[model samples]
Target: MNKRLNSVMARVAAAGWLIAAMLSAETVTARAEAVVAPADGYGFSVGAPMTWMSRAEADGELDAAARTGASWLRVFIDWSRVEPMPGAYNWGYVDHWINGALARGIRVLGLIGYSPDWARAPGVYFTGPPTDPAVFASFVTTVVQRYGDRVANWEIWNEPNLPLFWGYLGDRAAGYTELLKAAYPAVKAVQPGSTVIAGGLSPAFAPDAPPTFVAEMYDRGAKGFFDAMAMHPYVFPHGLEADTLNGWSDVERVRQLMVANGDGDKKIWMTEMGAPTSAPTAEGVSQQEQAKQILDGLRRAAQTPYSGPAFIFSIRDSDTANQDNREDNFGALVTTDWQPKLAASALAR
Candidate 1:
């Protein structure tokens, strides 16, 4: 009787454990299902900034981008690159890319940020946050006034969360919010119907960065500032089908945060997402894997109900090609010869 009683207790404990595991899995499945519905309005569009293309080469590259089903193109209107001096501006170069893309029937997302030497922190790089928000806002006004007629969508910066871009290295979202607060109204003042998107936040470990940085932006009164939020959900070194529990799937996590903040009506753009196809590194995948990931990434974004336009990092690999450099190979869609990459062909279909 004692042996039988012990066996019954063990069975009961095992059943309880099994039931708990099943419930936990059901919760995860429900969360994943929440993001799988097709998004409205824009759905999914593929495109990248062909920034490195020569002025003469832009038309051809853009033509190729259209062939691959890219409906929108992204280009940087770098403040330092466009306004090298305090008062002077260079409109010819950027005009060429924007006009060429528009002529090809593709819309554009113009990224405008980065400080000129005059405005940057002394002895540091221009990618650093500017010393004055007024100076940065003035630059924003000038750019929008000139190109606002053509470029309806503008991204305030690239990746403010990373030290490489924001450059302050410590809690900088407050500073960025100030910049965005200044720029957003200035942008709307020029192009009332325009959509001003926050800079694409890269997945960084910093406190005031992606995942958490977004929440901070709202806390700092960033609600009415921009029309949409952007993020770079690059899941390199991992397959596209990798588990969502990992940081990469935090794109959905961000959506949850948006809903909680009463901004669920707004869309989240996956501004940059890709895996490099170079020699294996901490974040690099194989060439064949690159092709698969690109397609899978597109499908995932398209199915997510809150997602907007998704741009692959680039249209062509940088000219300085290196087998060992993963950054040089993120463009698995094209070869150095301008020929189609395995991923590019796959995306075309």
Candidate 2:
């Protein structure tokens, strides 16, 4: 072969090799991009405090909630609400909400709290925490039987550490633990696979977060009473940053408790965390940025190994609570005349 012809053949071979290399790189990049990533942060669920559901019938609220980027809805069940009168249980309101929510693909986490005045021992909050734990257990069992198939996650009470939620009980742990001791077994007996979520203490340094809360459970020769931990890390507007959420002592508070109790693998479900979104307050995540904070916090939580799900503190404003009500404004989404706020729209699923 002549030198020029040989050189031309060699150039063609090199060009083909270069083309093949480029094609391989492109394929690899495409493959890498194609791999589906898991949900680092889950979609937030809206909670409907018992107060809201108590006043009126459950309506398009569930649908509106589903649209607000929430895959779950927290509905607190008052033993009073369903069985407000002894021996005569009324399931009207609950039936409407649960069936409606499920029909629309919204998961419900039932928060079961406070005994009815009728069921309570006289003088326990004008009536009392059931004097007989078994009676409370029976109450829990009846509830489980009624809605067990529809609801998977059940919270024992709300902010058991707070006096208001506990009906001004002085002994938070003993009071809550006594109720749980009976309630948990009753619930499990009826629904063996049910997730019994111990109510979280309202985030406070006050009462110093009872050292024996979880410790005593273990100390009493108890083995893992709960499948997951519930935390009410109320990250106010100013404290919604990733660092702030990550820095909270609640993480370590429960983490050590779990490890000490030999339930290190147990997960954490942030039952409630929220902030106001009215305009842009000086100390809070603004309406505009609230969305950003939620998206960021959710993503961070998803990335955490043992984190389960988070239910934002509320759906609508509580009319019953007073203006000093920090809770009145914590409805991650607010409604007036059936219209949703921009923050709610931004986080739409």
Candidate 3:
């Protein structure tokens, strides 16, 4: 009888432990699901000026972003500006943007790149790849440790496939892969829950298109280095469905490549997508067309199963007066004077 009682007690304890373990697993799954599903479906790029704006101006911009129903804001965590020298650092600008966005209930995707003069070789552009991946990784680790509590998503670089950004030397894909490999692990080590995104690939042709570049990254062992891939699919002067090379359609090809490489479970973030209303010559579109294309891109991204948040190129125009420079007019949601554009109304709907 004593032996039988002991056996029964042991079985009961085992059952209780098993039930608790099951509950723990379920809880983890629930949390993961919540993390993946963003509160707002899309985000907006507030441009590079967030670092320099006065608190009042930054608040106003963030208010405008929130009004558009954006739950995320893509801002640059520019290394050159933040850490101009080896040990010198500036957090004033970064703090204003990150805290302001959070105050408005918007999450931040911190795009980290641009080598400071000290970090790169002499005569190299600030946008050039760092002379040492470890140096860049150290900067990344420091940034993550500083803002990891508030900013969980980090992009390693921006448009590295382009010579203008990555410098005109070495293999672009190989060099970028090394940077990602270094930065991703550094970020993860500091904050295990952080999501390290590959630099947003620019829409280019031939040897530099997003699909081709992504494939090359994979070839250079880029897989598993990032939680998600990013693309700047700016199909300007063309509709979302237009059959043009290096257009929005390339996103699918990139996705297909990811799937083939057993990374289908990951997402592809449309980090920048928009058209300039006052673009140069044939590249410019009417305000109405800009609104339509942006809306269509947002809807398509939201509906796609493997897509991450789609961030419009800008929340407001950098300069509406600069009609010849397409870069200044990508802001379809708001004008520089704090006025809402047609796309803003459509987005609110």
Candidate 4:
């Protein structure tokens, strides 16, 4: 998540919203129910920018993704991008990516989230919670009605426990629970078999740690709303077994919390996990180290019966030139010029 790309997408989403509002007055239609099978293996995230890529570029990227033997692809079904205004939708962008992935034999874990300008809470950033949870639910309803047949897994939001993604407003866990409570039933109503994953909790400390935040969600009555818990246990420079706070080990705490809350049967899906290879910073790891950490994380998750499909953060570098920005270097499969990285071959095996 590059803020600059986010800003650019926000503007583009706003423009699409305006255009849809002007040209259409269509209301959401009910769709026949369908069963969506669960994902059986791990995959890579191509990120949100795929919605904006040229056909040749997007296909090339998906071609690379297919070569890695990925069974799933995590795509952002950004609410802001789809519906900028109430009852208005522009689905061309999302349709292309989702349909393309399906064609390539890849199932999609649609990460549906973010608020448009009209729906966002006043004075908060674009990532803020919506003014009304029902409005967000309605958006979820529309999404499921349209893409539920193809996209089986739906993640409620992106890292709601972190202020960077969810603005510092009211209680973060409570706010997120409201969205999940509203969305869970809506997705079920549209597609009863779909897997509604809780927002992937980011690795953080203090009140926002995975354990603490999950406890807060359960306390706020969030247990039954999701079929699985999602986490982004990115312990970059550190190995997957690192003992430090906010590292991959904390996921065990979250699982224990879930069992304590009487939801022990549910699995924890590692939706985003990867290490950047940028130099001169403690956070950066060597390309070989990056591959090793990611492979270890995936193997650990796979061996845990209570853990579901794990996805690497991205497929290719967003910008290799930005040596200082770690986010731009999380791509495990390729460099900015589409050259294969060490992790690409490692993952393919």
Which of candidates 2 and 3 reaches a greater lDDT? 3
Instruction: List ranges where model 3 is wrong by over 4 Å.
Output: 1-40, 243-245, 279-282
- After TM-score superposition, what is the CA distance of residue 84 in candidate 3 from its true location, in Å? 0.4
Q: Highest TM-score among the candidates is held by which one? A: 4
Put down candidate 3 lDDT per residue, 263-292, tens digits, no spaces: 999888888888888855837787767767
Instruction: List, residue by residue over 147-182, the lDDT tens digit for candidate 1.
Output: 888898888887887777886556667778888998
RMSD of each: 17.6, 17.0, 16.5, 11.9
lDDT of every model, 2 decimals: 0.69, 0.60, 0.77, 0.78
Candidate achieving higher TM-score, 1 or 4: 4
> Which should have the higher lDDT, number 1 or number 3?
3
Which residue pairs come into collision in candidate 1?
A: 333-341
- Over 203-222, each residue of candidate 2 has an lDDT whose tens digit, in order, gives 66545353346666556543
- RMSD score of candidate 1 (Å): 17.6
lDDT tens readout by residue for model 4, 16-129: 332332233231110001111124588887666776766555655666667667888888888887888877898987887788789989989999888998998678888888
Clashing pairs in 2: 40-302, 69-349, 124-127, 124-128
Clashes of each: 1, 4, 0, 0
